[model samples]
Target: MLKKLNYTNGLLNQMKHSIILLGATGFTGKLIAEKLDKDSVTFTICGRSLEKLQYLTEKCTHNHECLVLDVMKEEKIKSVLFQYEIVINCVGPFNLWGNFIRNFCVQHGKIYIDISGEQSFIEQSFMMDKLAKEKGATIIHSVSFESCMADIIASEMLDSALKYSDISSYYFFRNSKPSPGTKLTMQLSKHFPTFFIHNGKMENASPLAFHKYISFDFLPGFTKALFMPYPEILFFNKKYKVNHSASYLMLNHSDAMFLLASRKQPIESVDKILKKHQSRKHNLNENDIAKQEFTLVVQAIAEDGIKITKYVHGRNMYGITAFLVSYLVKQINSGLLLKKGIVTPSETGAWSGLWNVLIKEKLITHVQELQSDEK
Candidate 1:
């Protein structure tokens, strides 16, 4: 459940001395750092390797600090984290490496955000709402492409619906591959629980459950979407008071078959197989990035029997994630986010704001509201 909706103006606007970018040497981390640099946000890049940190700093147009601290070293991580008021953590699979850092941040009342979509990690973070509130900490998880965009869209739809009974989000992606960090999360998350909201309660379920085919009005044919335990399910139901909330990921026949086959294998065996696949990294060229597309369809059924559907389509997930991270930083740095506690993007009262920005930036190629009779 969300804390009280007490949105504040930029209370910390004058406190933007420095922002810390943890896991700065990773793929998504580098993208975020580059975006921050381009936006003229002063930040420090941190990782275990001084060489890689220096390399990233050298590419920045603006002056930025670099710190070489191993993630496993608790003291070092704490010392560096304490020095900055804001911390952007791109470290993952967060299910393994997230608990300590988040705990420290919450205890110290620091503003912490991470590009994590792991359901378990997010759920764990949500449990700290009380501590975060008492400590005056603002903790936001899954501020990346996987959840933040969808969360914002859902919030907008829910607000329009006013009294929503059911909400569902369908994610469609084409010609895109998961980053190494995402792959690692996928491999490790098998051990975590998958759940959904039903009648205002959480129910555990199997991964890729509730298989169904959906035909979109803007798209060509029927696409297969399976239930995926995305963080949006929790946020939508909790924040919007929706009785039922569901999230689905579009998959192809081959992908479905692969997932089903892997489900039957032992966890160890599956990890090995995934690791082998992860070894072969396919670099996406310009054409590949252009071909990669993402579409999100959010439908909410109002208590009054009205149905509202909204969708947003875009390309290049990584670029969008980077942009979203930077945008969140700007919002927090400007003290636009006034809530103090565990929060999602929408709960910050900036969902529509981010939605407008996405459209204005052309990151969202299409935004539409379909008539009830349409789809």
Candidate 2:
């Protein structure tokens, strides 16, 4: 049996309030650092390069510290982690370095957060859930623009629609470019099997099966979406008890074909190429980010054949992710999120609060609900 830590409100505050950002020099990491600084949140920026870390720290609007540390060095990583209450990991291809960081956090009883969208990493992390609970460590994965947006939206919709209906399916449609780190992670995760929840069980499915077009009531015309293994399936299935759920990425027909063709190449070679590309500095411009948008649609069916659909539209995936991370920190600091264990954003009991924050920040501009009677 695993041992449990004695946690009080004071201990929780002391252990879950402070922040440390790993990979602080990366694109998303830098954005998160900037937001934290803008919010005047006390945090330490850590990475392997002192020069890069210092450069980022110098640009912060508020005072912050920088640490030169390597994730591979377990002792050093653990030592540094011990000093902070929470660690916000902006590292990518989490398949490579996430396990070590996660293990250290669990063993040390530290609260951990990551914006990882890799399906394999999320699945592997779920195995640590019991251990994390035992240690009173909260590990939140996929707390980012991709999965969290879908997770929270689906969760909130389900909570409201559960009274008169059961969720038959949920779909996510995103229309935005991915960051370099996201590209790298996608390359590394291409070989993993795609999955969706069916009958309360995770089932493997072919990506090619989702090539068909889907139309949203809120959006004009039909848009092509491809099935992808998303962390939301794992997060929602456990909590919502949905019968079937699948996530799709919006893509044009040509892009869909290219995706299929690219899978034929050797995974190792592709990963090497992506890694090289990621090594270069590719920051997104404000104008380009301003043009980005995302849409999520949820469909539920009542026993009497009434179908209900919900939609949420948002902007700037990366910016929204950074803001969401900082918002979560605020909640943690305020003692609003103190659950001892691995939890999802929806499970944090802060969805309503987060929704309000998202609206307040103007990150989300539209929300709608539609009901139709079908035979």
Candidate 3:
């Protein structure tokens, strides 16, 4: 169940000097740091390596400080986190170190955000909801390119419906390659069972269940979308009261099949391979990112047989994520987010305005809505 907490107005305005970013030396972390610097936002960068942190700080156009602290050290983590009003964690495979920071934020009543895409980590976060509400802590995970985008599009489509509707299906399509961080996260998740929402509850499902081809209005040929477990299944199902929903990845059939087959390998071997991949420099270039495109298609059906089909189109997942995190920080700093507690992007009161900004900035290129004739 979702917990509600009171929003302390003027709280954020008082926290001018209380922002720190964890994992500041990572690939996505560096992008976020660059964005923060370009926006002239005053924030401290932190990670385990002082050398890398210093390098990032120096690269920033705006002045920023760097701190070196390992998340595995509880006392050290708490001591550093206590001084910040908000922390944007870019550390990946969040199932490992995410809980430490989340617990600190809740205990200190500090706002927390992370770019985690791990379903297990997200599901585990729900247990903190009650404590977070009591402490007046606001936490939002999976603020990255895919999960948050899926949640926002789902919320928008549900809100636009004339009647109560159940999310029938959600589809994710990206024309770009995954970042090293994303690849590592995917590798880590290979051992976990895939899940989908059915009758407002989550159930384990077979990988083969999602192997079928799906058609999209924007694209000509049918594309295969593999069944994937995204955080939205839990977040959106609870917030929107969705009866049934599932997410699919737009991948070729062979690629999807290979991913499914990979699950049978030992976790240790998979982790080793992923670690090697993560060590390589695999940043997406501007020219490639500029050519990248992502699209989400959501279909919701009301009890009376009416159907609402919505399409949200965007470009460059990584660029959009950086812009989103920066925008969210600015809003939180301005006290624009009125709700406090563990929340999703759709549940935030500032989402509608943020949506407009996304469109204006071309982070979101188009949103189309269509109504079925049955109604």
Candidate 4:
């Protein structure tokens, strides 16, 4: 349903940065802008708040242009996007505000990236594959802490020639706080169906559809894990051609808010609640980030009954997200993105051994692999 647009001018050579970042006033957006500025990558930051954007620019070393543009204005967005070769979107509740921007980028053959973890948004993004390939545009979603680690670990586990029958990823977070954008996305996601790969096909289910108790080597005992739909569920299944794939999140009753909103709650009611909730909270501070700990466990079951489990330990989810997005943007600019259509973080092969890079930067503390035979 999307058509490609032809541009006569070579905008890539004309723009100083060739990159435009939307939602630069948001939490993750600010971090990404700071990281890019620190790395000396000149870019233009656009958002609704000119004052905040100017304040951000004042603190940065580079003179990145700041533009006050509302995302809801399609014509203005299209005009601005025409001048950039790449667009990094940090807008939240992506299922709501993500469509026009993504469609515009794909139609215009621009490299589009977003840190969206909303499963519905991710599924919708996947639908753009055909159109993206036709337009010669590369669209990648969820390149942040949400599912990049899972994709990376799964790609590593598939290094052998063996065919995997099943793939599972688990996430555990400690001493961390969700950013306002993340919180809103979580609240909005409850309205969408959860998904997983079954028999090499995608299926929808309820949030926390399947629950079980599982233990990791790093944990003291078995903990409750809920089957939470994630971006990697689709990525691992499609990228690795696996028959079955699922992902889980470790949570307790107190963490029920992280799982799903009440089914009886109306959309208006939820929005009102979220507006109030987000106002009282701010981004994670350094002390909170210092205490943050996370573990990503990935397991793959081969057709021959052999299972390989890998673990990645890291700190500060948002920090990792900022660094990863910055790294991916750099890779894109350096011509490392080889695919022409919609892609997962690991599909481009640029992320191969990225775990090592994280480890080198002290973002990740440990990486281990263990193999066993299913009885």
Clashes of each: 1, 0, 0, 0
Which residue pairs in candidate 4 have backbone atoms (N, alpha carbon, C) closer than 3 angstroms, thus clashing? none
Off by over 4 Å in 3: 1-16, 159-175, 206-209, 252-283
Predict model 4's lDDT versus the native.
0.79
Per-residue lDDT of model 3, residues 70-147, tens digit only: 777787666567768889999876876687788788877888988887777777677878888899888888787777
| Cα-based lDDT for every prediction | 0.77, 0.73, 0.73, 0.79
Among all windows of 10 consecutive residues in model 2, the one with the lowest summed lDDT is: 1-10
Relative to the true structure, candidate 1 reaches a TM of 0.87
Scored by lDDT, the top model is 4
Q: Which candidate leads in TM-score?
A: 4
- Measured with C-alpha atoms, the lDDT of residue 287 in candidate 1 is 56
RMSD (Cα, Å) of model 2? 6.5
Ranking the candidates on lDDT from highest down gives 4, 1, 2, 3
Per-residue lDDT of 1-375 in model 2, one digit per residue for the tens? Answer: 111223243132234327889988888898898998898888878787877876787788776666676787876676567767798998777877788988888887888999988777778777888888899898888878878877776666565334333443334445456778877767666556557776657887755455557666566643776777778877766676556677776665677788778767665765566668857777666667767877766666655777778777878878988998888887788787567777887777655666667788888888777878977
TM-score of each: 0.87, 0.86, 0.86, 0.89
Of 2 and 4, which scores higher on TM-score?
4
Clashing pairs in 1: 10-335
lDDT of 1 by residue, 1-375 (tens): 111112124122223346889898887898899999999888877787767777777788887766666788787676667667888888887877888999999999988889888777778777889989999999988888877878887766567436667788888888877777776677766678867878867888777767777767776653777888888887775677677777888776788667667778666654574567568774644355556789888888777778888888888788888998888788767778568998887777645466667777777788888747323
